[model samples]
Target: MKVFEPVVRLMNRLKYAQKFIVIAVVFVLVIASVSFILMQRMNSEITEMEQRYEGASYNTALKDVLQQVQIHRGTSVQAWNGSEDAQSKLASIREQANRALHVLNEQHTKQTYPLHIDEELDAINEQWQAIAEKDRWQDRDELTTLHTNLTTFIIETMLTVSNESSLQLARSPASQNLIATLTKTMPSVTENAGNLRWLGASVLAKEGDMTAQERAHISEKFYLMIEEFATIDADLQRAFTDPDIQAAVQSTYEEATAANELYATMVEQLLNGETANLTSAAFFEAATNTINLQFDLYSTSLAHLTTLMEQQLSELKMNRIMLVLLETLIVLVAMYLFMGFYIGIKRSITTIEQAAISIAEGDLTTSIHLHTKDEMLEIEHAFNKMTTGLQSLVKEIGESSQYVTASSEELHVGVEETTKSIMHVAEMMSDVSEGANEQTARLQQSEDALQHMTNDVAQIVTNSEDVAQLALTTMTLAHDGNDVMQQSSTQMNTIQQSVETTQHMIEALHGRSEQITHILQLITGVAEQTNLLSLNASIEAARAGEYGKGFAVVANEVGKLAAEARNAAHEVGTLVQGIQKDTTTSVQLMGDVTTQVRTGMDLSTTTAQKFEQIVSSMEQLSEQINGIIVNSSQVASSTEQVVTAIDAMKVISTKNMAASTEVATATEQQNASMEEMAASATELATMSETLQTLIQRFKV
Candidate 1:
């Protein structure tokens, strides 16, 4: 029991296929075992029936032959009395007896009988041979004894066979008892009636030579015969149940009793020494005929009983045949159902295998359709789910990739335009610086010659006007720089919006990758379950012994397929992880790009403010120059003031130049970052394309 515990546990955990096979095998084995047992029982019954029939037939034929032999012996005894036709009748009887014996011998050789019965037959044959060789009545008494013993042996053998055959046919104890009584009583009745005839014949044949003692002895034998006949009649009344057999038995008893009464009367007279009035020959004749009549009636009853038993045996044989046929039909039907179940399972497994093959071949469009409501249906549902998830993820990646690519391109262009604008602003500031230095040189010359300042005042006013004109031109350039800054700011705003959009797309792609990972996990779980199921099936197939070898092979193949599916799922999972990592990185890059774009927008706005300040200062300087031109007398004082204003202008220009340089450096950094971003986006797009290509392998 302890050893079997693990086996029992294993069976309990068997998969659907293994469970199905076990059930089918057990059902078939049980049915086959039952069929085999039924067939064996049927064969046993048939053998018993055959034995009964053969035994009964042999007994009946042997009895008939023995009776014929007995009749022939009686004829030979009568032939010794010198009747005119007795000799020829005796010869004819002998020939008939010999033929009967010959037939019995032929039959005996063909059939099987008990050893005791064979010995009996051999004894009877020996007795008959001895009798045939005797030519005289010198040993008449011995012959009588021998004849009686032979008759008794034959009768006993017949009765024994009859009883055995009866027991075989009897279905109940009551029937057996009834048959036993009939067998004993009928043969006893026949033998006693024949004994009465022999006793009466002996009395009449030897009456004249009989002494007193011999006469008394004959009287005692007569009384004994009468008693035996009465016993037979009583037994018949008690045992016989059939109306026909009862009537026949009753008639036989009546005739035997009447003959016994007649013989008794004859014996009484002979014992009383009153034979003077008796016609012994006529009385003996009447007595012989009465006894013969009784024997015929008893024989008829026995024959009828034998016929009934034979008919029963025949019916039993037919019933057994029908029972065997029914069992055969049951076995055939069981086999048919077993085969049907086997075929159904095989076909289902085959379908599953085909579906696996399609999946392995990268056909994501192939749908697994099954009408069965078993384990295969569960697998189909899981597979469908996995494919659907994969398709959705791939589609999202593709859309996100295209969006990232476009955003990167837009950001790159914006960075280039901002850089060019900053460079142009730097060049304009350098020209303004050169013009301020020349204005300072002219102021220093005016201070050196105060006496000649009046003359130089006109030159200074002219220079001031020129300087004013230069300031006006510089202001125009500043306004142009401001406009460029404004355009740059707008482009930076556009880049920022694109970066935000790209960030959102990347975030979405990251989420999709996560979803793909989850789907891959589910697929992996299903594959593992399939592998376990296949393993269990293989175990059960091995337990099925020789019959399961093919099934084992199929199970092994299924296991391999499940393993391949698992490996595929793992591969998909790895790819999803890579996609997830890339999406995460892309998201981070988009974030950085968005921050850079915002910074560029702020720088452009600051540059625009500085340009506006420059323009205001230029307007003031131009107004101051106009005052100097109108009042040339204060030229010397205005010169110093003009020089100071020029210095302030130079300082503002230097600040503007520094600001432009910072803007240019920022733009250059932004451009480099955009280039990096563009490269990252390209890589992301390539990854997305790869993912899409991988997803196309599976059929939804």
Candidate 2:
């Protein structure tokens, strides 16, 4: 069992084409075997039929010849005792007997008879020739012995023929039935012939010595035999079809009818007690001879008919055997050619399938080899071409993958450097934001000092209504206000420059974010292309069906990877979009900061101008101090106006500080956005590196 296991496995692994070839070969072999067996059986049947036919023909011819000889002997005896007309009748019977013997000999010569039967026939012929050559019949006893021997030989031959007929009939029912009918009628004819012979012998007895009762008994027997013979004759005439056999039967019936008429006339004379002109010996001889001749002719005709039938059956059997053999030969030849063509196709298909399997297993290097000029050869060529194309495609893919890996590595490095640059820019933005916050604090302190200076000016102006004293204090406060305004202008200019720098940085960040978005778009395109390739692979796998099931699994994994890449790209796209949105917001905030810085600078210029106006007004107040006592009421009003102006300047400083604080907040938001952008870029770089690594796994 173990030894055969590998053989069984090998058979199981046979390609469909090989399996089909095996099945077709087996089928043809089975048909050929069956046909051979049938041919053998038919040959056997033909042989058996030939044997039966030969036996029946030989026996029938022998039987006919014997019966003819018996008739001829009876006619010779009739001629020896009968009237003048009897000689001619004897001559006719002798001619008929000779003719029948000639026909029997002719038939024997034509057929290849069995050795044993031929020996028997030769002996009979020799005996018949010896008897025929005798000059005279010595005694009744000797004639009777000769007749008995002939009868015995005829009976034995008939029995042998009957046995052969029986076997032949067992094989064929139609022939059996026809032959059976003829055999059934034969016994009645034989009995009638024997009775007729007895009647002839009784009639030849001395006329005076014969009793009336004996005459009547003989007449009655004769009438009965004649009636039976007439009936059998009618049957034969109706049943027999062969021209020679029918003619013989008809002639026999005529002779028997003539003999019956003659015997009836003799009986009529005996009954009437009239002197019959005919001699009893001559009348008896003539009647018995005619009756014997009629009986012999009937038997001979029947035997001849049976011989013909057997000959026909034998011919038909031979023809059938020939036909069967011819058909079998044709079938065998056709099957042989079919098997050859089948094997050729099987070889071609097997070669193609092996090539297909090798290709399926990723052995694109394996070459397909097939020798034919048919469709299978075309398929082989196509298969080789397909393998070559696949090899080239794989080679190209391997090279492209190497290039892609190198390019991705370079891109990863570039992205990493860009990320670091973005991080540094973010840190610088953070510091700029901190400086803006400090500037805002200094502005707030300056606003508080201006408020204290405004309150002190209001108190001094109220206390000093004298012109000189009021002018001196107001001039000192004006000088201090000019210094404070100059300092606030300087701080505002510094803040404006910072805002401009922050705006410029935000613009650069926005441009970088746009670039990142473009890169994300490229990544998305790559993912889409990968997905498309995976889909194409899936389609090819589906086309390959069961053979590509393993490849289908690989394609499915590739599809999953493509889906993962697409998802990653989508995530990157989302992150880039977030960065873009943040960048846009930062640009808007920077623009707002720029606008606030400009407003703060304008406010600082207005405050500096107000400080100049205060200094000029202080100088005018010192020059007009002599007239102060006269315009004490006006000075007091002017001091109140100065206090109001100081309060308004403090409000302007407070707004400038708030604007600076908002700028600082906007800068901080921008810095955070830049940081996020840098992180996103770093992530994108990592993803690109991962993509390159994954691509590296596919070797051409």
lDDT of 1 at 579: 48
**Per-residue lDDT of model 2, residues 85-140, tens digit only:** 54567556656656766766776677653434455556666666666666567764
TM-score, each model?
Answer: 0.54, 0.57
Clashes of each: 6, 0
True-structure lDDT of candidate 1: 0.54
Task: After superposing candidate 2 on the true structure, give the runs of residues whose Cα lies further than 4 Å from its correct spot.
Answer: 1-186, 207-356, 362-425, 444-488, 518-526, 554-558, 605-700
Error of 2 at 37 (Å): 14
Candidate 1 collision pairs:
362-697, 363-699, 364-698, 364-699, 364-700, 365-699
Candidate 1: stretches off by over 4 Å: 1-32, 72-89, 112-116, 159-169, 172-183, 206-313, 316-324, 343-676, 696-700
Q: Identify the leading candidate in terms of lDDT.
A: 2
